[model samples]
Target: MCKPLSDAISQGRVSTEEGERKVWAALEAAISHFIEGGLVTDDLMKQLLPRKYEHWELRSRKPRPSLRVFGRFAMPDVFVGTHVERRDRLGAKWSPQWEHQKLVCEDHWNEAGLPAPFTDQPSFLYERYITSNARQKIRVQL
Candidate 1:
């Protein structure tokens, strides 16, 4: 789980208790599927949908209020969540919050020394593990 995401949930920064519960439930389900070496796709669960921002693949979870987990596949089975943005129903469908997170992820990726995105071809640089079905590997820091 992401620290910021967890902090948001724990701090009750969500819209409502029901929304919070739904987000947590959806997260648990996704984690379970990940642990079972399964891809959490729209087919498996409608909530976990793949979204693209340039070459980055983000996993967005639309709970009651829509909690967006911005991340990219560090590896096929490894999704590193970088930021969490909460969207209340009254807000615009799209927000600059998402763009900000995308920028943060890009900077973090560059800092981490990950392969750079192909500028000419606009191809995914982390596509090497696309076919991998490895079990969920959670990297916990003590």
Candidate 2:
């Protein structure tokens, strides 16, 4: 997690305590799944389109008040979370929010001097960065 995201989580900006807890649980499950070499599906993690954003979101969609954590992959499996927001709050005007989060991530990458995020076909990225399980899932999408 980046400083801003960490602070947001710590400061209870996600929602009520219960909402925060749910989001935290979702985040932890996603992290553990990724670290354990499990196949992560789109429901838990999704890459933003247009490729220009180069952003991915970790989603927590249950228990109402869904949450989205925006970030970029620092390396193969290393995700640097930069911002988080509740889905309900974003409402229908979510594109601008996504753009803002993407900028936040890019700025963080520049400030930290991290290498550029991986940019390639979803198939290629899955093949190169993650385990083979993702190949089957991505094939259908591609």
* Tens digits of per-residue lDDT for model 2, 1-142: 7777778766654566776677666765666776677776676667776655578877777666677888777666677777787787664635786667677777866777778876655454544545444542444554
Candidate 2 vs. true structure, TM-score: 0.74
Q: Which 10 residues in a row give candidate 2 its minimum summed lDDT?
A: 130-139
Q: Which pairs, if any, clash in model 1?
A: none
Error of 2 at 72 (Å): 1.4
Clash count for candidate 1 is 0
Model 2 error, position 40 (Å): 0.7
lDDT of 1 by residue, 1-142 (tens): 4455467556654546766777766755655665576754333322121233433333335565555555555545455554455545224534565455567766665665665432312343233333444322334689
**Once model 1 is optimally superposed onto the true structure by TM-score, how far is the C-alpha of residue 26 displaced, in angstroms?**
1.7
TM-score of 1: 0.52
